[model samples]
Target: MKNTPLNLCTTRLHGGEYGLYVALRERADNVMNAETEPIYGHKPARYLLQEIAAGNKEYSELLLSKETVIGRRETGEILHELALLQTHLWKAGRVLRVRFLEGPEHVHRQIETIAKTWETHANITFDFIAQGQAEVRISFTRSGSWSLVGTDALTERDQNKATMNFDLSDETTSPDAFPATILHEFGHCLGCVHEHQSPAAAIQWNKPLIYSRLFQAYGWDRQKVDTNFFEQAEKALITNSGYDPLSIMHYSFPPEFTVPPTPTPHNTQLSAQDIAFISRCYPFPASSTASTLLKG
Candidate 1:
């Protein structure tokens, strides 16, 4: 894949390289299914026993990722950019601080209003702060909407600069751009990678169509298209063998974008699988999600 520095799917990492940033997939990949055993991110037995004994099983699940990957996520980078998806995850139950560097109050309000939908299902929270160094500093620049996924948002060279963006000047460019784009970008902030990149998405893309369409629509070159759409994320991000085409994180592909012309509509809201992914990644007390190794 081409090493595109900045474009759509702006998952920033070290060395100015853009990549996917999926948090829980690295640690709590099993949270998607209650019946299946966890594949990764198991907490220590002593901590599990303590949490269970204290009746705080829910919070313990939230601690799974951080506690599990203390030294695990630092492996060698792979050719398909798998390591790019594996890092910068926040520990579960983190209150992600958000601040708008510049935008209308109503836009900010709408952004916050829509963001709560994700919070209801996940353990993560968004604290929209007026001042201070925020994890997500959003700007309404014309440079197109993008975000530094996961904890990478905190890695900006200039702390005062925006780590996320909302280019709302051309809302008519896509359906449900107001809230859908917001949800899509915030999904990145939560360490959720693009659904199209999921291993389950065995989409036979119309290559020529994708290249031309993206070039005409978003001004993205072939390399950027390959980096964002053609590339697939690791199987660790999959909750099940089935791909979720209705996922809010999946881009709205026109009919011609696919080989068989299967079109993905503009999804303004999160899918059931999207909820499950987020919930598993951010275990809440109400969800009662268990760690992979521990039976609590």
Candidate 2:
């Protein structure tokens, strides 16, 4: 496989947050395997619904993009890829099991606390299991923080390995560690994408400046910059909650990276919109009667 850049730096708060980034570049000689699944084929129909619930219209369009038809031999059985706008929520009220493959026990509790903030508003529940295959396996390494989006966690071949990773090793002990970063990665686990990538967010990016800074800061090449910062999610795939500049899922860009020199703020907590959006996506069953009535 060709070398693909790692998707690091979900929250680039400062130089300290990038400690792992520097180490990873030196260790891998500035190249790492993409280690992600292919994007072709039908993802779960619920993902489409999840996008819609987040108020993205492009998701519905993406669902209508194309279909694959499979014809059978003797029995004339046929398989077809249909575009269905279904809820991508975990089995309605299922407890998503999580486990830590690495990281100190203290940090594990911290991670759990940060993750469960989503449960306060959303109907989803996370159960941290002591053993066995967990729905979300979290590990720590020099690789910058990232998590597989939503149901893609189930597609991993190495069941014992982690589907998510954070830069929470011993060397990365900064006071500002698990605030927004944990919320951002867990947002990805719940099927959220970078808020900046939303088509509605018309950020006037200073492309040359962004490219130059990232290359110098993280050893990122042109392709990596494009994929991580410039490439917009397919309108059909995005569940836009309207261009929220304060969303926990947004990255703080330096003033130099923007056209008019506007410095994007580092969001330390979930914005009110973030809470409202997740609530809509995974509302408490009892309080979701209005949503059900609307659907009906």
Candidate 3:
């Protein structure tokens, strides 16, 4: 029951289509299975936005066919630029409060210890509170680990509910995987996307082979495979950080996934580039007064 790393997409509506946006959001939320482990949940709204921004003719036609009017003024260029800027990083100098919704004391202690490793380098702070509303609520489940990306947690309807989950209940989650899993999910919470999806990575994926493997392994259909693996991210949507195959944000791919059999090893720790990139994204100000609280 080892949880796969899943990225949650956040949507922003423009052109006063708040009603339409809400309808879309409700549809997306309702379809997400709370117990199912999604390799990358097939998020139509997110997929539509990404595709429309990339100017994919097929998706554009699909949007039009569905009678979904992306406002005339909301050009693909504007959406692409805005999506790139907003989704790349969180606001600096923010104290993100984290609360444990459900977990044994030992597991909670371990998570608290490992999660703070990011705070040592980044400007952000993870304040673990006991009895108040928190920005990040964590819980444990048998399904694979996942988290909403960055500011998307703030948009959740249940403000006090858990926004991140760890698969501690899974007996298959080894001790070696614990730190990596926690760090990886927290990476998502910090606005980092899968390193494999980095526009600069330029991975040569063997589509038919990948589709066959994912379908057999995860019950994913053609659409899910295309959305999760085959889709190339918009180059403009990426941060300036150069690609690093060693990033903890990357999932190890087997040789078969690539045309020339490029096998990426499973990364269990943050690369040097990871620290530098996160630091740049959330730089600590010299005049900052907030204290870093490390819980053992």
Candidate 4:
């Protein structure tokens, strides 16, 4: 998730004040179960229809209904992210032009897959320009301490306009797995902070000492832990009750990050709640316009 398009889990800030950080999670078993609805992202047909009735347009005329999409569940969650991204584009009154740049290796192809998946869900058009130059470059600590992962981003005034470079060379990840991370980081790029880290997150933290223990086990220093873990916790402290621990933004440590209670896996895949939140947060203009037309 880090290289082609960054995911939000893998990288971390090294010894600098405002340097780049990437975060990728510990890779889970990549074998996806077709029967299991991915932890989130499935929209019930009735609900989707109800929302459409509320004023949203069905951009996906050629695509299956929400129910059919879930019943088959043939594709991965990348499609869901694309749909959500499209919703945001509609709301923001903007069009995101996605281009896949060819890199020296297969890395660029992976990035292309991530972008293309989004294009499909959002029902947007894009261009794939394969220039030989790497689409992205990896940034790291001078000490060779860390490589960019999905969870991290370099903090710079110029970072706003700069396209991030993600490092995908690490052997610990699977193809589909990285896409979720990429989606999360892209969420960050779009200005989303961690849901778990919100003020509402504290109510959901459930375990405190466990998190303490986790920090100890990983030898994760206080500063790194603050940025990666506590910052979100602090955010949770102030936010409202929509906090979902099963959120892809959450980490796997049990109650508190202590005794590894019940390994509540951090869903790398988007959840239904996440999809709804994205739809509301970022509805595409056409979708919004259609929604308004329906209301009127």
Q: For each candidate, what is the lDDT?
A: 0.64, 0.60, 0.63, 0.39
After superposition, candidate 2 runs with Cα above 4 Å error: 1-89, 169-173, 287-296
Best candidate (score: TM-score):
1
- For model 2 the TM-score comes to 0.67
Per-residue accuracy of model 3 over 10-76 as CA lDDT, tens digit each: 1121221332233233323323224211522333345564455476745345434544334432333
Q: Give the TM-score of candidate 1.
A: 0.70
Per-residue lDDT tens digits for candidate 1, residues 2-74, read: 2111125555443322212222232333232232223332233234434544777543253333444324441
**Residue-level error in angstroms, candidate 1, position 186:** 0.6
Better of 3 and 4 by lDDT: 3
Error of 2 at 193 (Å): 0.6
Which candidate should be chosen as best, given lDDT against the real structure?
Answer: 1
lDDT of 2 by residue, 91-129 (tens): 445588999997789889988998999888777789998
The superposed Cα distance between candidate 4 and the true structure at residue 241, in angstroms, equals 6.8
The superposed Cα distance between candidate 4 and the true structure at residue 64, in angstroms, equals: 56
Q: Model 1 lDDT vs. the true structure?
A: 0.64
* Span of 10 residues, lowest total lDDT, candidate 2: 75-84
Q: What is the C-alpha RMSD of each candidate to the true structure, in Å?
A: 9.8, 13.4, 11.8, 17.7
